[model samples]
Target: MKRLALILTLLSAPAVAQDAGLAARDAAEALEAASILLDTAEDSRDRVAALTDTVRAFEDGLAAMRDGLRDAAIRETELTRKLAAQDAEVAQLLGALSALGSRAEPQTLLHPQGPLGTARSGMLVAAVTPGLAAKAAALRSDLEEVTALRELQQSAAKTLEDGLAGVQRARTDLSQAIADRTDLPKRFTEDPIRTQILISATETLNGFASGLSQITENEVAEVMPPIEDRKGILQLPVRGVIIRQAGQADAAGVTRPGIVMATRPSALVTTPTAATIRYNGPLLDYGLVSILEPQGDLLFVLAGLDAVFGEIGDVLPAGSPVGLMGGDGGDIVSLTSEGGGAGRSETLYIEVREGGTPVDPLTWFTTE
Candidate 1:
């Protein structure tokens, strides 16, 4: 009976730990890949894109590490509780084994029921001894795993620190590369006088959008490939979750003719399709904004950015980084947060205008 209890003590661990172990290994591999990316970023022909990739790699790795750590914490807590609960039974098993070994010779072994009982007791002990050894081996493995998990958590702190630093460096490099970039095609140079006059005259977004063509430096009418066929399938300019639909009011009871998306701080904001930059600066109530014209008479308005990329007249290809969301993005405490990026999110406001009329952005981009 004691032997059975001993085996039970070592056998109740859930299969959850195996998943955590796999996650930890995968996180380590991802971190290694990010490190390699950082090392090779400087040599890439397109430093902006390379650095962006590096930063994304680091973010993915850190997120995985956070998940693994959370799982390890939960598993360790369960193990501690289980082992503590079985302490009394384990002690009883040890006591019984001790009594069986106290007698040096088999002939000297005695039972209250005389020789027959003694023989039966010896036979039972012999039958169960190998099973006890196997259970003891399993208990040792569990204890070792617990120790390893603790060590992994401690070591991950440094990895988290390095990942944070590496990603920041990559982001900085990307920003600099964008600033120094000058190879993009120009649809039309922006005239400052026209832009300021238009802003001063317009009272609303619709009015401002209507006057976009008037700000052109030289109105030769540059023709570009049409994206009318790409409607309802365009990717979002940034990776985010839609928080508010078009015309939805906020806590302040103010509503706008645009959709709001919540995204992680410092996340890269890209153009969903090939577009010409009609404007890229602060406008009226909107913070920093990027106005893109994907086709004639159609405009995409992106607002609330910390940094803007590309010049006013530059025509950008698809997936080009337009700017970055606002935030420090270096929250060390969130390194072990289960879902990762526990920091507050920055919001991006997006609006689609067709022939100067505001329409639901979901008409072009799906939330999924």
Candidate 2:
């Protein structure tokens, strides 16, 4: 009976060893299954089931697989914490992406307060599962792409707005400039200086046209009556007022011009048929003035003599010296010449232009 008991104990020892090994294997399998559950679980209910199953297996083989059970528990704890944190972060990321899509919000890379894409979701997955880290990187690239596209769209919108504003400003300024120019002509007409310039231009233009026809000394000589013969007729030399008759005054208010000779009341001034006379007359209030009646136009005879020599109706014999200066000065002359004379004298106011268009006398008399 003692020998039979010993053999039975040796056989039971092999069975006991086999049972312990099987328990260790089952514990390892439970740990692996729990890890997979943590990696893929989307909710707390699933995670709880995996955790319960793993813990039950660990307890069942506690005595035979203590070390393995401890290791599995540690792994499960770490994976659980990581997964929980990852889920929370993923939820936040999803919320952020949703907020970015709202239309009423202003534009921004993060929607003013949140992310613009689901790429952040991969970050959570990576925290819990190292094997998925590469996928997380790919998701990050997607986030960057969407962000860049949004920024480009916003930039384009701003550029178009700015361009329209610039165009409007330019149009307004151009209109103002046109208005300013239109008012310039009226201003020029009101200004004294500008009026004077107009007067000068008018004279220049008239003179250019007048140069085409000129009278000659021969014409004047032919028209003049014979001086030596008493039967010769006397014609009006110039048709105009005696603007200033021959006159003068002494230290006690004496006499001058007419004192020397007789002048007609109104005469028709004429020129010789073929003569060129450039004569400087007297120094009157109207400075040293002159008269030139060429031999081309018989009716054209320049006769504002600030200085006069020949008497009224006197035959000058064509190119002969008519007279000496009788400058309009002092009292009487000032009434007529005003600023036209040298210092202010009543001088001849000659205006004999075609078409009745009055011109500046100075231009026609001198080369300048």
Off by over 4 Å in 2: 1-293, 298-320, 324-346, 352-363
Mind giving the per-residue lDDT tens digits that candidate 2 earns over 1-368?
22123223223333322232233344334433434443443244433233333322322222223332233234334434555667766665556556544342323322233463433543443364443345455445444433333332233223223322332332233233323322111100123343334434444324422432221122223332322231113222232223222344535675432211112211112332222332333322334333333322312233444333322222233433332223211111111221222222222433323232443332233211
Where's the lowest-lDDT run of ten residues in candidate 1? 1-10
Tens digits of per-residue lDDT for model 1, 1-368: 22222223223333445455455557666877888898998899988778777877877776666666667777777777877887886787677667666444766556789989999977887788777667666667767667666655565555667777777888888889888877787878888998999989988888888888899876557577887787899988876667788999999999988998887778788889989998999888889999998888889999999989998888888888899899977764343343322443788999999888888998998656
Q: Tell me the whole-model lDDT of each prediction, alpha carbons only.
A: 0.76, 0.32
In candidate 1, position 4 carries an lDDT of 28
Go through the candidates in order and give the clash count of each.
Answer: 0, 55
TM-score of 1: 0.78
Candidate 2 overall lDDT versus native: 0.32
Q: What is the TM-score of each candidate against the true structure?
A: 0.78, 0.16
lDDT of 1 at 45: 90
Candidate 1 segments exceeding 4 Å error: 1-18, 81-109, 116-141, 200-203, 246-249, 253-257, 333-344, 366-368
